[model samples]
Target: MSNLPTINTDTIWAILQDKISDEVVNQLVWSCLGYIYDETKQAWDISKVVDDWGEKYPEPPDFIANRPPTVKLTRSIPQENKQLLKEKLGFKGYKLGEFGPRETRRATAANWLLSYLETH
Candidate 1:
């Protein structure tokens, strides 16, 4: 986690320029740039075990098209006012049955940024 926002390719290259391997970057792209691995042989083979990937999905989905949009609370409210709002509100950041690795990662990263900004 970092104080910086979640990234895209240009930002990633700008931040990581010359400090990484192409192999690792490509693997990361493969893992995160959205595709499903279809391995029928493993599912068909008696000797091999097949996994459903345990309900996990690619974040950007060439697989599941159901990923929710990123949310932004863009208004700049005073800290005291924000605190008051929080005290008055009971809000759901996520809906039931919508939790996934991608969602958790996003929430955790944003939380990290918020905490870091508060501290610094």
Candidate 2:
């Protein structure tokens, strides 16, 4: 029982227009929600699971709450899909100097896309 915000999968489905699979979307959203997959065990790694926050604790922890929502596209999604998302979402400034390093640009674009989808 964590206090992290839940993503609306319906919104993702609508935005992706069936270009990406539902399973991959689930994996991306779950990763963003702090669940990591353990390949050797072939299951979720829950050792680092956060404790249930009581009703009084209404928000996620600072580390999660402070940052913009982002998916680790490098690890969870294919590079081709990442590029497709950038193109579809009209993300600019993806070059090295245009928006920091490669990873930063990708992450920024991902965050931007997420925010866009969630809002509209």
Candidate 3:
């Protein structure tokens, strides 16, 4: 059988704790999903904003630009990786019912990562 890549929870936790905040992660999730925070409306809305990896679109705004280059920003985690993270991190669903309305998988994952860092 082939060897599987190892995940270092301690290192991942440390990065989450030291490099980024839950709020910023949430914003990054939205950015990855093609949404932008409208300061005037005080809400997130669908926009043409591009992520760091988007070469065809315009440059990322400050909210996305200011993030540490090492942070992994994506629209969604692949199923296998998500399962691996859940198993290693000992967490449940990405949905956070206590926080109110349901969020996208990406947002929920971001929120969960931050929550895990905060509580653990």
Clashing pairs in 2: none
**Residue range 54-83, candidate 1, lDDT tens digits:** 223222222111223222121222344333
Regions more than 4 Å wrong, model 1: 1-91
lDDT per residue as tens, model 2, 12-116: 434234343334444444455445557787766644433332121222222222233233323334444545344655545345664433335334334434653
Please, what is the TM-score per model? 0.27, 0.31, 0.31
Consecutive 10-residue window with the lowest summed lDDT within model 2? 56-65
- Residue 19 in candidate 1 has what lDDT? 38
| Candidate ordering by lDDT (highest first) | 2, 3, 1
For model 1, state the Cα shift of residue 5 in Å: 6.1
